[model samples]
Target: DLAVLKSKFRGALVGSLLGDCLGAPFEGELVSSGDKIVIQKYFDKLESPDLKGPIRSYTDDTAMMKSVAKTFIDKPEVDYTYMAKLFVKEYFAEPKRGYGESIVEVFSKLRKRKFEDVYKPAQEQFNGSGSFGNGGGMRVAPVALYFYNNYDAMIDVAKKSTQLTHTHSLGVHGAVFQCIAVSQALACNPKKKIDPEQFCNELKQKMKEVEKENDDGLNLKVEQPYVDKINVIQHFLKAKYNDELDEEIGIVLGNNICAIESVPTALYCFLRSLEEIPTVKTDNIFRRTIQYAITLGGDTDTIACMAGGIAGAYLGEEAINRNMAKQCESYEKTIEMADSLYNAVCGASNRA
Candidate 1:
């Protein structure tokens, strides 16, 4: 049983890294089926033993993901400020990782020791409205995996961890939703078939409770408001993906960096890719998950990274493309960190 969970634990992290690394090159391009083929061809090229030149590099997605993983590894209970320090540490170690604009200010403010408040800058962003970007969601898988046994802890800890860099309820809710998705996925019996219908409904119910508690002025009457977005994902999951489906999903579900738009969309991509989609030819569900997410085009790296984390939790490393994974910077290191995180969780479980 531990072995299965371990594989899934590793899968969740590795999937996040692979998606980030592979999806980084085409981050902002508006891609089509033709563009999807180009991405598929790039993967085909990875099968070669002697590949030449710059492999696609991971951006802030993988960097902060590692921070989150390291946070879980270093502190079993997940200290918010300590986790924030990891984010600050990673940015200063290598500033050229193509971090998003708003996050850079968060990093700089954290670096100065004069101010003891680590979360002040983030709360002050957008003229005190704060950033609602998916930065919090992108790096939250580790939190889910670490707290898989305790849903209440997972929700509270996810919020605290997210608030380290993103204080807005939009940013915080995305992390909460993503963490629960990953947590639920990890708890699933690897041997049992997943019911997409039941899975999405459970998430929506839980998120409904969360959103109702923390009303961020997002009117409940709005169609597909936060919790309702998960319902939309359930809609796409039951249908086969087509050209029209692609366009509609991009419009309604979205594929951008905002936590509001991208988080639920990533969940949709993972769930929909689990079944056969005749339009995309790839049979590797993991690859299909990332491919389909990227095809949507906006915020490719972060969306793929998020989708990959979900799919990986269900599919494990066996579904991943190793050659493609190896192309990413710090590939082995991330994998090792994943394994280490697994050990930490298992050790905690044993103690409990």
Candidate 2:
């Protein structure tokens, strides 16, 4: 069972890395004639012989993901406090990774002998409510894998992980919804045909309960408000990007917090490529999905990473672009971690 799961985990890592690489060269580029002209320009320059800029690298998305993978190898259990400490450690180790301003400040305090006071300062940092960034959802695919056989445990760990940095309800909810999507995909019985509609419908039902029971701050209704939008699923299926690429999807999905933005946006990416599952090549289908996200502009890395996780789970290692996948500095390490986590899972299951 875990062998199958390990294959999926490797797939997700490759998808995440491929998406990050494609989108990295295009971060913040506005769509020109529905084409990522600026992104193409940058890639062209990077591919040139005489370019002088620093090499393009993955931001916080990959770093946080490595942290999650490390936790899986070391703990194999969800420990929020430990996870938060790891997040701080990783960010400090590579201060140049793609951390947000709020995150930067939070970790600064954590490093300045104020470790226990991280959350209190965060509440004040975001006008007394705390951040709702997509940071929580971006690094949670490992949770989906870690709890692939236990949905209840999956939901619990997802919530704790978000609160460590993002204490906002939407942030927590976003992680819940995205993990559900990935886990459900990973856990699907291979005998049955994959149905994207059925998958999303189940997610809608589960998230309804999460919203109703949500006790975090930022007062709002428990139910997500966008489930009924006409052609919403179809739009997602078609990979139809929003018209304006500069503004964040949070504005459409309701801010980049856990619930409103990252969850649905990531789900939309999955839906767009869901039909290509088990057959789609990483360079073609995966690139199209992530490139579409970059064309939407804001929060490009998180969008790419979130959506990339879903695609990766579905496609496994087969969906990744070989060249790009090989270029990932952490590619070999990710594979080793996946194998260790898989062995650990097998060991635990055998004992049971």
Candidate 3:
């Protein structure tokens, strides 16, 4: 079990890296039916053992994810301020990682204000509504892995860490939803097939609890958006996979940057990829998950990254292709971070 957990940790972090790296090149492109063929071939080329090219570069998704993992490994106690600093530091060190304009502004403010109030800048964004973007959900894999055994702590840290930039209930709860998905995937045995219906049902139940607690007396148009998305994901999954179905999913579940749009879409990607996709020619489910996500288009990197994390957590490292993973930037360092996180958790548990 320890070995399995360790492999899952590696799978999750590395899977996230692979998705961001591979998906970055295609971000924001509308995936027409013709485009799916190009995406399929692209994946085939990346998997070829003899293929040689520059390693695929990751976007801000993996950049922020790395900082989150580092924070957990370096600090036993959760440190929101330190985590905020790491985000700012990583962004400044490499400003060209495709971060969104809003988050960049938050980083700039955090530095200007000396991080005296780490959560203030984000709270001030978008005329106090705050961002409901998928930024928080994209980087939440570390929180899921670190607090793998503690459900309450995982949800708590997921919300707090996300609040460092995303304070909107939708933004915060979406991150929590993503965190729960990854945690559930990590708990699954790689040797067994996952029942997609059961998986969504479990997620829906947990998200309902999360949404109930999030009732802040603000009567928003959609009271339980994520819960509604989970219902949509369940509905979509029941239908046979087809081009038409894919279009419906894009329209209904969405493939955009908003957390409400992308997070559940990522979960749908993971669940749908469990079976063979007619368009994608992969025997490997992990490949199928991300490749399917990319074909859905908008916010490609982050959606693929989030979906990949869930798939990889379910499948563990062995399910991921070694040759394909080597094509991503920071693959080695990502593995090291995963191992360090595993040790940090296991070491603390053993000591206790």
Candidate 4:
């Protein structure tokens, strides 16, 4: 079981890295029906054993995720200040990772304030409504993997760490939703086929509780937004895959940077890829998950990153093509980080 878990840890991190690197090229372009064909060929080429283009570079999604995992590995205690410092340090060290303007502001403010109030900069964003961007959800895979066995701790840390940059209820809950999805995927047996209906139902129930606890009674425009998104995901999953259907999903589920839009979209991508996609032409579900996420178009890197993390958590590292994984920049370092996070958690549990 430990061996299987270790492989999963690697799978989740590598999957996240591959998605960011591979999906970065098409982050904002809207994919038409014809574009899917080009996308399919693109994946086919990427998977070729002999193909040697420049390694696909990762974006901010991975840049931030590495900091999150490092915080867990290097600190025996959960330290928000330390994690905040890592995020600022990483951002400043390499400012061209495609970080959004809003987060750049948050990082600068954090550094200026000397991390005295880690959450203040984020809370001050968008006229004090905070960021609803998927920045939180995009980088949350490490929390899911680190607290895979501890559901309450997973939820707690997911919310707190996300609050460091995203305090909006939608942003915070979306990260929670993504974290729960990855952990659920991690718990499934890799040898068994995933039941999409069952997976949606379980996610729906858990999200009900998560949403209920966070109800502020002021934002009544949408009740239980993430839960409603899960229901929509279920509906879309049961429908046959088609270009028209994808259009509807894009309109309804969305593919933007907003956590409410993109996080559920990522979860849907992972679940839908569980079956054969007529266009993708991949028997490998791991590839299907990220590729399908990319095909959805907007915010490609983060959506793919989140979906890839969930898919990898389920399938383990062996299911990912080594060639494809090697194509991502820092792929080796991602594996090492996953291993360190695993050893940190499991090693502590063993000592306990």
Candidate 5:
């Protein structure tokens, strides 16, 4: 039984890396405009060879997520400052692995040893309101597992982590909401599948009060964060412009810049894939999901990564073909990290 849990844990991490690597080489090319036929062609043609490269490494999304998992593994307590320092170090260490412009600026300041000042005028990054990019949401999955037992605590750590670089209301909200969704799914009864609408509604209800409180304190009149999340989820359910193999369905989440757009899109993909598993007649759900991810153009890696986590959660690791899952370059390290993190999570649960 413990082996099953461990294998499932490894599957989650490996699934994430597999998708990240598969889509990293095609980070920005997956965009398709209303040409349904062309979109279908694109999705049908995505190949694993297309993802092969000497530099086909995971991006900031995977790096930060692994760090979050590491933090939970090493310490009995969650340290915000330690996590912030790790985030700064990783961004500065490799500043060119496909970071957004605003994030680039933030990391640039950190590189110049201005880590403390990076957050100073953070509210001015996006039209004087701050960023709403998917960067935050992309890396927030570990927080779901880390704080699964305490929903409020998960929200706090998630907001804190996003605020480290993304101070925008929507950005932080997306991270919090996505993590909550993952946590809920992880803890959800296997017999009772998660209901997409009800999930979004629950998230909206939980986040509305806190978001409103913060907006009131800052004198900023932004709509509730969960509202944006729900909007994305709604889009995911209603918008299916392409086939299961078509890429357009993936990018419909918006250019992956909007956290509201990307996170829910990934969740929707997860839901779609889960629904497809029993009846789709595909032995390669991992391959199908990756192909589906790449056709959705723009922010390919992040979308793929999100979809990977969801698939890993539902399918467990053994369900994925070993060759594809094991093909990851950093296979050993990622699995080790995931195992340690899982043990930490279980240990934490036992103590409680």
Candidate 6:
């Protein structure tokens, strides 16, 4: 059981890394399902023995995620200022990661004026309206992993961390939604059967608890728009659409970088594709899920990263393609980080 749990923790982070790297090249490409064949072929080549060097690279999504994990490892408590500094520092250390422009503004503001209050710059964005972009959700898996045993604290910290850069209701909720999803994935027993209905119900309830609070001008009120998206997610999965499901989901949910659209889309991809590995049918279920997410196009890396996080939590490290995993940039470093987080989680469990 501990082995399975360890594999899952490693899987969540490593899977996120692979998805980001594999999907990086197609980040901005507007691909169609027609490209499914090409995508499959692209992944097929990863099995070749002659393949050399890293197969793909990661972008800002994975970069920020590392910061979140490191922040937790260094400081187990939810210190917004310390975590925010990690994010800002990471962006400045390597600006070429292609962080979203709005986030860059927030990072730049943080750098320009060193404020004792780390959240001030982000709260002041959009003429004080704040950014609703998906930057917050993109990097929140670590929060889920770090606070796996503490859902209440996870919700609170997730919201605070997101608002550090994205203060809009949708933005804030997006990170919380993703955090809850990852936390559930990590909590699951990989050896047991996964109940889709029960899974959705439990997460939906957690979300309801998360949202059913008073908003003291903090944009934290539980609203229907994001929940409606989750509802749509449940609805689509239940109906189990025909050949038109992918396109329908794209049209209905979208796959852009905005946390509202992309986060749910990623969740839908992971949940729906778990039954069968779409066109490719790769041996590794985790890779298959990531590839399936990539075929949907439109912010492939982020969607794949988010989906990969959930899938990894469910499938564990064995589900990842060994060749593909080996070729990812910073594969060793990523593995080390996963183990670090896993050990930290285990330590917490022992203490409890």
Sorted by TM-score, highest first, which candidate order results?
3, 4, 1, 6, 2, 5
Q: Give per-model CA RMSD.
A: 2.4, 5.1, 1.7, 1.7, 4.7, 2.7
Which 10 residues in a row give candidate 5 its minimum summed lDDT?
A: 274-283
Per-residue lDDT over 260-285 for candidate 6, one digit per residue giving the tens place of the 0 to 100 score: 78998888888877677457567666
TM-score of each: 0.93, 0.80, 0.97, 0.97, 0.78, 0.92
Model 3: per-residue Cα lDDT at residue 7 = 96
Model 6 stretches astray by more than 4 angstroms: 53-55, 213-222, 348-352
Cα lDDT tens digits, model 3, 1-352, are 8999999999999999998999999899989999999999999988899888798999999999998989888888888899999999999999999998798889999999999999999999899999899999999999999999999889999999999999888899999999999999999999999999999899989998898866667756437889999999988888888888888888899999999999999999999999999999999999999999999999999999999999999999898998899999999999999999999998774310
Pairs clashing in candidate 6? none
For residue 318, model 4's alpha carbon misses the true position, in angstroms, by 0.7
Model 2 TM-score relative to the real fold: 0.80
Candidate structures ordered by lDDT, highest first: 3, 4, 1, 6, 5, 2
Candidate 2, superposed: residue stretches over 4 Å from native: 34-56, 117-124, 189-193, 214-231, 234-259, 275-284, 349-352
Given candidate 3, what's the lDDT at residue 90?
Answer: 97
Poorest lDDT segment (10 consecutive residues) of candidate 6: 343-352
Better of 1 and 2 by lDDT: 1
Q: Evaluate residue 61 in candidate 6 and report its C-alpha lDDT on the 0 to 100 scale.
A: 88
TM-score of 3: 0.97
The TM-score between candidate 6 and the true structure equals: 0.92
Please give the lDDT score for candidate 6: 0.81
lDDT per model vs. reference? 0.83, 0.64, 0.93, 0.92, 0.65, 0.81
* lDDT for residue 201 in candidate 6, whole number 0-100: 79
Our tally of clashes for model 3 stands at: 0
Error of 5 at 105 (Å): 2.9
By the lDDT metric, which is better: model 3 or model 4?
Answer: 3
